[model samples]
Target: MVIVSVVGGISLLLLVFLWSIKRGQKTVRAFVFLSAVADGNSVESANELAKRIDLFAASELQKKAMIMVEMVFGGSQLKLISHARREGFDQ
Candidate 1:
């Protein structure tokens, strides 16, 4: 019985770890998508991208993406806001 319980616990932990890795992959994909959109230099495109990002589950990747976006766009708040509203961000 003890061995069975131990194995069950380890299996649960393994499942949780795999789930976390999957979530991280999603975040990375979103970040890459954001980079591609930002490179286009179109506010409309960015806004559309923002809409897509909103569909993602909340995560730290969103904050990192914002920082990267600001740097890419020359750190201008006006430009960022104009292109992508910070409201309801997932990126």
Candidate 2:
């Protein structure tokens, strides 16, 4: 009975560990999708994204995605300002 209980406890811990890893992967995938959208390019398929995600650390992937988003936002803001200037809105 003691052996069975030990095995069951270990199994539970292993399952929890696997769950956390899967959750982290989903978070990374979401970040990658956001970056892809911000860049206005074709979004990667799930398998492609999963493969790419596996290549980098989760934190690294998140950081790169955020930088991509920031750049896209910055560029769009500049373009808006340029358009406003062309329309003489500043005056």
TM-score of each: 0.46, 0.54
Candidate 1, run of 10 with poorest lDDT: 81-90
lDDT of 1 by residue, 1-91 (tens): 9999999999999999988665444444445444555586354555455445432533546577557546766754344443433432244
Model 2 off-target regions past 4 Å?
44-50, 62-91
What digit string (tens of lDDT, one per residue) describes model 2 on residues 1-91?
A: 9999999999999999988666555545555544444455444443354346663566567555445435654524334334323433221
- Overall lDDT per candidate, in order of appearance: 0.53, 0.52
Pairs clashing within candidate 2: none
